[model samples]
Structures are given as structure tokens and as C-alpha cells.
Target: MPRAYEEIADERQHGRDTHVRRPRARVVRDSGRHQWEKDRARRPPAVRAATGATERDTGLLPDDLVFSARYRTIEAPGELAEAFGVCEGTALLERSYRTRYAAETAPFSLVTSYLPHALAAANPDLLDVSREPWPGGTHHQLSTVGIEIDRVEERVSARPPTPQETRELELPAGTAVILVRKTSYDTRGRIVDVSDVVLPGDRTELFFTTRLERW
Candidate 1:
């Protein structure tokens, strides 16, 4: 009986030792860094590229103004002012026009603006109209022209086109209008001019080209 009791006590001790030596369950607290890393990894690479540097570093070009006069006669002076969002009486000078072959069948129109003709002409370098690299924005271009741009006022309106405008300008379906008004000032603190631009969104593709030079 004594030997049996001793053997039973030794068995119980071995069982207790085995339980103590077994691995405990570990609880890892979440810190949220793993989830954040996962979310960042899922975003598009272009978003990361654009956010990584300034315009100069990324070699992006300035905005190009694209105009189409396919269906209209020469735009009137007042109409030009209305289109550009400038004040009334701002003169509209026809800078240049060319008939270019887009594809074999579709021949599109091209029009360029000498913006300084309406406003006061600054120095040559200030009004350089060549295809040089520039930042992509209207305000940025106006800044290069020596015009003190205050703010951009946008107005969108749609109306049935007049018989003449519709026939000449070639109105299409869903042909509403977009007007961007740019208010600028001169060195004398006087409101120099306001420019408004009208665009037919379907046919016009504004091309902005920028080339970055080596440091």
C-alpha cells in the first residue's frame, strides 16, 4: 500500500511538470502599422510619383490653350471678350489660323492667341510665345506675361444658339458652354483686363507640352 501511494504521488508530480513546461498561448497586440502598410501598397504608382516631387523635378510642361473655330465665322470683338471673360470693349485680334489635316477625313482648325495684344505688351521675354517649357495652368502663364492675376472666376451657362451662331459654329448635341474668367491687374494697381474663354469640350483637346533641361 505504501509503495502504491508513492508511485501515485510521483505520477502526479510528472504530470504537473509536463503542464508547466508546455508553451503558453501568446497574444500579439495590433499596432496598426501592418494595416497602414497594406493600404499604401494598394495605391496606384502614378499617385505616388506625382506626390514625390515638385513640377520642376517631375519634368512636367505648362498648359497649352486649344481653340477650335471650325463652324464659326471670324469671332466678333465683343464675342471674343465674352468668350475670354474679359471686360467689354476688349479688342479681339485674329492672331493666326491654319487648316491642318487631322486624319484623312477629319480636317480640324487651329487658332493661337497673342494674349498681350489685348493687354499691355510687356518685354519680349515676358511675352515669348514660343513652344518653351512652362507650368500647366492659365494663372501660371499669365504670371509669366507680367499680368498680376488676382483670382479665377468660372461661369457655366447654356442657351439655344442663335441661328447664325449655330450654323457657323456647328452646334452639337449637349452643346452647353464653359466660360473661365481671369481677372488681372497692372503695376499701377488698375484692373488691366479680364479674359474669358469658350470651349466646346468634345472637339478640343488642349495640349500642354513641357521639356525639362539638365541641371
Candidate 2:
């Protein structure tokens, strides 16, 4: 469900008050092989750009390649534990993905994705890093195990890059990093995926479109 519609608002004017209905964003059901293919084709642009050096960047990410991909079972950390609503030390899968331009010394971005170990373990291919950048991304990976992502929420923040980040991104002086935490939910409103993305702020932009209801 969209958080935007979770709370209703009252419109008051000319000493009169009225309630405005806030309908949640609509979701269409996906079916059959084509939908699956379409969804797989929807892999993050970043991944698409990373796959081939000849491909032009779609403005979302740089033309790069997956620097490395690996996974391990871990006791969910504080943030992951809370985000997944699991016990403090519940087991989960941590999939780390780093990208860099083949012709550049600095990294393009850092992405760390997480999923419930038990849920993901249902599909062995998901645990193999060699299968990355998995076609359709996490969505396809989840679908292989019957998970259908219904929505995603992103929270962005900024701060000075950590020494490690500065070194990894090879950022210049006075450059800060933007952190985007993305949470994905399934059809049952379960938090199926969570990821943290770090980007060199100098080359990133965020745009949001607010849809207004026609009363």
C-alpha cells in the first residue's frame, strides 16, 4: 500500500470543512510468460548499463560492470533485523554488489541487497554469485521462488562519505555521498527485499512526481 494514501486529509475553505478521499496507488496483476519476461526485462537500468560497455547510459547509472558479486549467510544486523521484523540474530542472505567503469579508477556505485535466507534458499541459483547480474534483478530472483514484488519504497539521505567510501568511490574533496535505502514489498505486504545504495553525489539526481487526485 502507498504511504501517501494511508492518512486522510481534511480540506477546509470558507469556514467549511470536507473530507477528501485518498485512494492508494493501483496495482495491476501480472500473468503468464510474457509478463514474466517483461518483468525480467525491467532489471534496474544500472544493471543493464553495467552489462555492456557499448550500451549508452540511460542517465540512471554509468556504463560499467559488476566488479564482484558474492553472498554469505549472516545473522541479520541491527538495521536488517529491524527492517525485516525478525529477531535480532535471525539468519539472512547478504548479497554485495559493486560496480565500476572498466576505463575508470573509481567505482560507479555500491549496492548491498538482502533477503530472507529461508525464502531465498528455495532457489539455489539465487545463492550463486556467478548468476549475476541476475536478469530482472531481485524481482526475477524472487519470482523464481513465487515472490511477486508489489511495491518499493526509497528513503534518501546525505552525509560526508566515510573514509572507506571516499577511497572506494575515489571522490574528490568536499564531495558528499547520497545513500538511498530501498525497501520492497510483496503482494502480501511482506518486506521481501531491502537494499542500500551509495552514490557519489556529484553525479546523481533524484526526481519525484507527486500525483494529485482530481476531486
Query: Model 1, 1-111: lDDT tens per residue?
Result: 234334444656676332222211111212232233233333455442332111222122212112222111133466555555666665433333222211111212222
* Cα-based lDDT for every prediction: 0.35, 0.66
Q: Which stretches of candidate 2 lie over 4 Å from their true place?
A: 1-38, 41-66
Evaluated with lDDT, which candidate comes out highest? Answer: 2
User: Each model's TM-score, in the order given?
Assistant: 0.33, 0.72
Best model per TM-score? 2
RMSD of 1: 27.4
